[model samples]
Target: MSSSTLGYLARRAAQKERVRILYRRALKNTLDWAVHRHLFYCDADELRAKFDANKHVEDLDTIDRLINEAEASYEKWQHPDPYIVPWAPAGSKFTRNPAPPQGVEIVYNYGKEESD
Candidate 1:
């Protein structure tokens, strides 16, 4: 194989790794939010008692429903703003006026015009 082919494969692998990392992070964040919202506030001992009372049944339809609702709420909270503002402190050297990229060039157009 040529060096350029190897380089292309390497870049593709790196890109896939980055995408996997982002997906894992997003999943972790969602799960953390769901658990924190649903179970973290409740007393663990009480939860254990409830589980024991139910004989540790794996049929958690109710719990699943509650968790689904919590996940929806978490999604709402996560994307409150369409734009993500920087967390940099005021007057920080890195804190500059945040704006979208000046000009975004589309490398491979996907059945859409450049202006579109």
Candidate 2:
């Protein structure tokens, strides 16, 4: 009901969002290193366990500190060359074949006789 309570709620929501984003990024980064789906699933479980270990912490400062540490670790261990979809930006097939130039007309002939 009070302004302090509202501020606390907002901070908590923001922290939760940051944690969610961090978890997703970490999982996606893990995929870059695990070449096989089976291995990725195992790694994913381990990563989940690590996050679950800290899920019970109620201190906001502690949560913030953990988040910062996780982010730093993520940056340090990120893959140098992550896999990208062929059609995605920076991929080999990205924009490889662009559309034809504007005002260019393409005619399709179906059994039409040519007149000289």
lDDT (Cα, tens digit) per residue for candidate 1, span 45-69: 4433533464433334543454445
lDDT of 1: 0.48
TM-score of 1: 0.31
What's the CA RMSD of model 2 in angstroms?
2.1
Q: Write the per-residue lDDT of candidate 2 for residues 1-116, one digit (tens) a residue.
A: 99999988999999999999999999999999999999999999999999999999998899999999999999998999998989999998999988779998767777787898
Give me the runs in candidate 1 sitting further than 4 Å from their true place: 35-116
Highest-scoring model, lDDT: 2
TM-score per candidate, in order?
0.31, 0.88
Q: Candidate 2 has which clashing residue pairs, if any? A: none
Q: For model 2, give the 10-residue run with minimal summed lDDT.
A: 104-113
lDDT of 2 at 1: 100
Quantify all predictions' global Cα lDDT against the true fold: 0.48, 0.94
How many clashing pairs per prediction, in order? 0, 0
